[model samples]
Structure formats: C-alpha cells, structure tokens
Target: MQTVASESGSTLRNYASILLLLGGICLGSLVGFIFGNKVEGVKFIGDIFLNLLFTAIIPLVFFTIASSIANLQKTERLGKLFGIVAGVFLLTVLISAAVMAGVMLLFPIDQGNTLRTIAAQALIDNPASAHQALTPSAGASLTQVLTVNDFFELMARKNMLALILISLLVGFATLRAGEKGKAFAQFLDSANEVMKQLLAMIMKIAPLGLGAYFAYQVGVFGPQLLGVYVHPLALYYATCAAYFVIFFSLYAYFAAGRLGLSIFWKNNLTPALTAIGTCSSIATIPANLLAAEKMQIPDYVRNIVIPLGAPIHKDGSSMSSIIKLALLFAMFGKDFSAPEMLLAIMGITVIVSVVEGGIPNGGYIGEVFAITAFGFPMEQALPVAMVIGTLVDPIATLLNANGDLVSAMMVTRIVEGKDWLSSRLNK
Candidate 1:
C-alpha cells in the first residue's frame, strides 16, 4: 500500500485544483452567455458563498483569540519581540499602501462610464442587508454608513470587530482572573475545542463557496473580463507580488549565510500551496509549521512567530485590501488624496490585523468584515469578497507563513547577537 505520507497525492491535487478552477471559469461563462440579460444566478451563488464564508466567524473568533491570548500571557520576553513585530507590521502596512496608491495613480481604472457601470452591476447583484442588529434609520447614505463611528457602532452591535474586541477582553481578563477565572476559562476552552471541530467541517464546504464564485465568474464575465480588468488587476497583483519578493530579497541578501531564492521557494512551496487550497493563513498553520521546520527556523521562533503572524501580520491581505478599496473608490470617481489613502490603510491595518485575531475562517470572515468596512453594498460585497477571497488568499497566506521563516532567521540572529546588517555593510 502507498504510504499516507506520500507527496504524490499533494502534487496531483495541486494540478487537479488548477484544472478545476480553469474549467469552472469556462463553464460559468458559457452559462452566462446562454442565459442572457436576465441572468442573476451569479448573485445567488455570491450569497451562498458569502454565507458559507461567515457562518462560523463569531464562534471561531471567540474561541481562538481567547486561547491564543491566554497562552501569550505566559511569555516574559515578549516586550522586544512585540516591538519588532509591530515595526514589521507597520512597515508592511506602509509598503502595501504605498504600492497600492502608486498603482492606482498610474493605471487610474477610471475607464469613463464603463467602470462605473461594472461597479453598479456588482452592487445590484450583491445588495447590503442589515446585520439584523444595527440597521440605520431609513435612507442612510453609504457615506453616513461608512463613517468611523458607524464602523465602531457595528462593533457594538456584535459585528466582527465587536466579536474580536470581546474575544480580546475575555481572553485577557481570563488570563488576569487566575484561579477565579478557571471555571470560565474551562467553559471557553470546551466551547473553543468544539467550535474548531465544527470548523473542520465548515472548511470542507469552502470549495463549494469558492466554486460558486468560479462558476459565476466563468458564467458571467468569462475570460473576457480578465482581458478588460487585466490592467487594474495586474497592478493589484503586482503590488502583492512586490511585497513577498522585495521584502524576502532584502532579508536574504543581507543575511550572513545568504538566503538563496531556490531555498526560499523550496521551503515555502507547501505553505503557499496550502494557502491556495485553504484560502487562509490561520487555516494553513500546520503546513506553515512544517515549512518553518524545513526552513530551519528555531523551535522557539517557529512556535511564536507563525501563530502571531497569522493573525496580525497580514502583509499580503492588507495590501490587497488597500488595492481593492482604492479600486472601489476609483469606480465612483471619488478622489481620495494619496495621504488619505495611506491613512485609511493604516486604520485598516489596525482593524484587520489587531482587532481580527483568532477569526474562525481567516479568508471568509476577514473578507466579509473587509467588504463591509470598505463600504460596498452587500450586493457588491459578495462577489468582490468571493473574488478577493480566492485571488489574494494563496499569496497572502504564503507571505504571512513566510514571515515566520524570516522572523525565525531574524530572531535567531538576534539571539546569537550576530549583526547580519553590519556584515552586509562590510562586504
């Protein structure tokens, strides 16, 4: 019998996934062409996928954040690591935001009225609904709904942010609560375990959700949209690509041992592939852990960095979100100043990276919160969410996963008191 550990299954599945994706795109387009002007099945598919993405968000966030935070409390050397991580986090935001803004300025997706028409079609198909808890009074403008206060108010109404905040509070409080919090912690612990098991089942359904988007994309836009949107999409994709390439290149070039491109690719392929399949850095933790070991990240750094990076170090996703948001604003002829876009990215980083810890489904849940945050109507939100959820995920998760490998190198270098930077200067 073939060993269960054989990589043959993985290699075959990777190719199979690519084939299915391409075929689905073709099939969805043919359906769209046949169905004509009245076709709205894409919207139905969008909704189903959106629901699938968000179904376990609240519970998953509550459990994982609580557990992860509780564990972090045991660390004493975190002060310096925290600072380093924050610096990396901020640099990531700045780089991503700048690249996105630069691309927006250069390409300027304002194809006169055609772009707006696309935006309108996307909106009609994915209309927003009240979260059942916090619908504003009649006739609130999208602008009014988009203000910072409204964002926070949504949190108060138990939206994703609210859930993240609650998880942090409960988790931190539990840590401080000590023996007094034991019973409560036990309850949460049990709840968290059960939810994760339930979550495994939810993940099995992701491809279904993902498939819907692929089906609709093929059915609606076919390969044609790729040509039309290629200009804008290329800019966005390049921005994401730039992040992993430039950052890792700089890190490796300066490292004393010289981190070769081949080694980097070899060590990271599994995590990247896993991220593509799972659409989540958080979900790909096991693969990421394995990749770290393969890359020779010390156990300590591997242990801490991967978990931390998964939640707050969304270098890929944050940048991609910024690009998408800029595109959305561009579609409406809204001219947000460069600095304002940068600021918005900063705010988004805080919201996405800090507040969204232990989210149940990293890709789906994060994308939902983001679609809503970026002020797309629920109609526009669904397809946009689906496309981005699929498109950005593999790369984003790969970047986030790779953060551990790099951080391990950096941290181990730090532990050894080696000045890799100084040596580069000497050379």
Candidate 2:
C-alpha cells in the first residue's frame, strides 16, 4: 500500500504524464475541430473515464471521513485540528473577498459592454429558461437534497451534503463504541484502502479519459465562447492566478514556517493541473488525497480536513463570487459604493462560496443564491451572472481543488508542527 501510495505521489513523474495527456488533448481538439463529425464517437472514452472516477467518490468520501474522524478520537488534538482548519478556511475566504473586491473596484466591469448586453438580453427575453439553465440540477429540489431513502440514495453524489453529515455522525458514534467500534473502524480503514487502490487504477487511465473529454468539450464549445468574452475571462483568470499565488502562498508560509513554499509547489503542481482538467473538486479528491499523502500530512489530517475542505474551503468560489456580484451590480446599474451594499455582498459571497457544490456550472447556482438571498434585481443580474458563472467555473474549480491540498498541508503543519516534512525526509 505504501509503495502504491508513493508511486501515486511521484510528483515529477506525474508532471511528465500530465504533459503527455495535455498533448493528447491538444491533438484531439485539433482533430475534433477539423473533423468533428468523424471524431464524435470518441467522446464515450471520456465519459467512461468520468464514470469510473464517479464510482469511487461516494465510498471514498464516506469511509475516509468516518475513519479519519474515528482515528482522531484517540488523539487529544481533534478539536485543535478542526479549529485550525475552520480558522484557515475563514481566513482564506476573507482574504479572497477583500482581494476580489479591490480588483473589481480597480478594473470595474463595464456595465454597458456587449457581453453584458448579451447576458441581459438572454435573461430579459426568457428569464425562466435562463433560470432553469443556470440553476444546478442537484440544488433544484431541496426535499430531494435533504431526504434520502435506502443506502444507495445516501451514497449518491448529489446527496454528498447528507453523506458527509451521516459520516460525521457515524464517526462520532464509532468513537464512543469502544472495543466493538474498533472492528468497524478497521473495516472502514480497509474500505478506504480499497478505494485508494481503485483510485490508483483509475489514475492510470485518467490521461486518456481526460484528454478525450477535453477534446470533445473544446470541440463542442469551440473558440466562440472565449473569443466573445475574452476581456472578462482574461481578467478573471489573471486575478485567480494572482489569488492562488499570493493567498495560498501566505497560508503555506504561516502553516509550515520556512519550508512552506517548497513543500507546497513540489506536492501541489500535478493536483492543480489535474483540477484544471477535471473541473470538479469532488472528482479531484483522489488526486488531492494522494498529494496530501505524499506531503507526509498525518493520515487523520489528510482524510478529514481534505474532504471537509472540499465543500467549505473555497478560495476560488469566493474570488469568483465577488467578480459575479460586482459585475451583476454593474449590469443593473446599482450603487455598490454604499457600505451596506458592500457588506451585504461580502457576507452573501462567503456563504455562497462555502455551500456551492462542485458540479459543472455550479457557480451559476451561486449567482441565483446571491440574487435571492440579498434581494438583488434578478432580471438584470441573471444574464450577467450566467455569463460570468459559466466562464469562471473552471477557474474556480482549479482554485477550489488546489486550496484543498494547501489547506491539508497547513492544518497538518499546525497540528503536527513545522518539521513534519523534514522529519519524513530524515527518515
């Protein structure tokens, strides 16, 4: 198991594999563009890959979370670990919100611009359709989201929120079960191991699957998506990159003291690139777990904090929310200069970022959340929200996943000490 784990952690070798996958994607896209009709059949290869990854997500999350928490019951620092992770999550969101607000203020989105008009017209013409399109399918029915019958429904990814809750409850119960619970915990640990082995197998084919998917996606969407919205997309990417480097770097430095940066980059790069391709933090958990393992993060910290962090620690969504809110207000010609409005935006954005699901166009649902919660003018903001949400969701996913690994390291460092990496090295 350790050998398999280390093989998964070979960051330098992962880079080479990543580059080859990237090449395949580029070549596939070029071919798909020139002969989309001929290459259309290859999309199923990508679907197969995603389906395989999806198969492991629920079980991996459940066993990993429950087992990690149960293990923490033996330690005195479970509360401290939770506190540090929560604190890091909150601090990162605040930093993201502040930086995003400042950036929007500096290079304010042009309200009357063509993209805004296109967004406004789409919403104005068919508001309901736009709403249906942007609203996440998973979030559409709160009843379904909250209530689940049978184990299968509970294990479904759409019900991940409930799964996490159930896992936490089970973990606490197991902690209190004493000797009998020890066997159950061992079962869960074995289950987690099975899932990790499954993950290693899945990753072996990820490059092929991801490449095909990217090719199909780019071929289908084409350059028109970017060509039309280059300005805003460019700004979004630039700021996102800045946030990852600056905010994430600071968090790493604080967490690990001197070796923070080195520890982060070496272990983090492949996962960041993986996030870019997967565009779903939930899907990236396998890779994130592997990277955390490679970083020598304590097992308890890696398992518990990383999964929890996926939903809660969202630097990317925070960054994108500010951009979406700022642009929406700009589109509606509202006065964001008011302190109350700014405060409202900040508060709502933080909430949305944390609760937002890790699904395609999930951030658009967040825009809808902002409009409903804060009573923003939906008719005007909806179109702009949809546009920004679609464009920035991938970048947001990148930040979201990358932040998970970083948060794992930081929490590990705080709970374990700064010399954790060096200790592993000296061994």
lDDT of 2 by residue, 162-191 (tens): 676687888888898988899999998888
Worst 10 residues of 2 by lDDT: 356-365
Clashes of 1: 8
lDDT of 1: 0.58
**Which digits, one per residue and each the tens of the lDDT, describe model 1 over residues 1-427?**
3775455576457445435544554555555556643445554664664564455555666687777666565564778876665666566556655666666777676545545665666655544433321332223453444432543443322255455666787789888988888788878878878877776666554455445554555455544544434565677667667767887766544343554344456677777767766556676788878876766655766787777777777666666666566655555445645565456555765466544445544554555565555445544444544454455556666666665556555655555445533443355
Model 2 residue 385 lDDT score: 58
**Candidate 1 residue runs with Cα over 4 Å from true position:** 1-6, 12-26, 41-49, 52-55, 111-114, 121-159, 193-229, 253-303, 336-338, 353-361, 413-427
Task: Estimate every model's Cα lDDT from 0 to 1.
Answer: 0.58, 0.68
**Error in Å for residue 323 of model 2:** 0.8
lDDT of 1 at 296: 61
What would the TM-scores of all predictions be?
0.72, 0.57
lDDT of 1 at 127: 47
